[model samples]
Target chain A: MASKPECACGDTSAVAGGKKRIIFPCAGTANVGLISNAAAFQLADEGYGVATCIALLGSADTGLRRRIAEADEVVIIDGCPATCGAKIADLQGIAIDQHIVITALGIDKVYERNYTEEEVERVVSAAWEGKGRT
Target chain B: MKIEVLGTGCMKCKRLLKNVEVAVQELGIAAEIKKVDDITEIINRGVMLTPALAVDGEMKVSGRVADVKELKEILKG
Candidate 1:
């Protein structure tokens, strides 16, 4: 049997063919904040989007801000109502396509440092589902 | 010269401000320094990160704290 060719279509990690999507997660101290960060990482690992540092956005790194401004889609995941992630995007005048607050997903906020895989998945799904909405 | 430190009043922001002051004092430069805490103004100035420094309306450093040595170098330019 012949070996099948490796399909690398739509691989953002390798290529820059299409519009880029950027994800910013609020890596706060709270458990919910950590969950959002985990979810953003998972989404990026799954090739849903590229997870970027919220601090970089907040700091207004010119290169990073330019990338955010030029990105085709921008998603912000905040852990709580503080909405630091979203606020950074808003302050940068970047249009966010999706804004997910982990607490609003029925996840209680705790001042812990760990989060479960399932909790992370739930946030990821919510953020993913938010895509393609008019 | 006009210098502005932009941040949301975070610890790093305060530290950056202090560093800037120290740098200014050491350099003996008669520069006007301002602290920008308003989110709207910060955004309008295209600064996304707190602890950002702008010299004469041009962003010089951002997203991290610059030590006195680093601030001196940035201000010397």
Candidate 2:
């Protein structure tokens, strides 16, 4: 396999009032998982910070780990209660600033890959509202 | 040169270690390869994914297996 080029040079400067945030979406194949992915995109598009790859973080990719470490806030958009993203982050000693479990937000986890934009918006709005904040 | 296979003793991790050994032998390079199954050590190495390859402390790959050819290229470098 070809070695992947490392994009370790990410903008570490604060985006949201001196807060540099990174979002980790579970991005599972299931519906809730898809929602999490969509929400991440929306969040990034809304200038909430960049949406990052969970696999790279799980692999402890050097550049990505550095980015996570530098970020003021680390958000995990887990698809379900299993919280795979959070679990992965924990293993890497990543201190999560905000945790959002889609199922916990009163959204049903349908096996089918069907989710409306509103559902994605709900997660995005929840993120802005700090609903998942401790 | 020093090479390390990072994993938690999973089947795939062992397989990667074995593959690396074969690659070194086939290439006729005198390289020392070690299996890092210790969790703390692996974490300190900055790896959360198993079956990872590190050449001289630089991570080559992780979260997936690389074939003999790929290992050979990494070793050659």
| Predicted model with the maximum lDDT | 2
Sliding window of 10 residues with minimal summed lDDT for model 1 chain A? A1-10
List of clashing residue pairs for candidate 2: none
Among all candidates shown, the one with the greatest TM-score: 2
lDDT per residue as tens, model 1, B1-77? 99999887765466567778878998999999999987777777776444678999999876655556667888999
In terms of lDDT, the poorest run of 10 residues in model 2 chain B is B61-70
Query: Would you list the clashing residue pairs of candidate 1?
Result: A58-B48, A58-B49, A59-B49, A60-B49
Residue A57 CA error for candidate 1 (Å)?
A: 0.8
Q: lDDT tens digits, residues A1-134, model 1?
A: 22322222223433323336798898998999889888888877655578999999878899997887667779888899998988887887777877888888889999988778889977866654452222
Off by over 4 Å in 1: A1-19, A131-134, B1-77
lDDT of 1 at B3: 92
Residue-level lDDT tens digits of model 2 in B1-77: 99998887654465567678868988999888988877777767666455688998899977544546668888888
Q: Model 1 compared with the native: what TM-score?
A: 0.55
The alpha-carbon RMSD values of the candidates against the true structure, listed in the order shown, are 19.1, 17.0
Looking at chain B only, the TM-scores across the models are 0.95, 0.94
The lDDT of each candidate is 0.74, 0.77
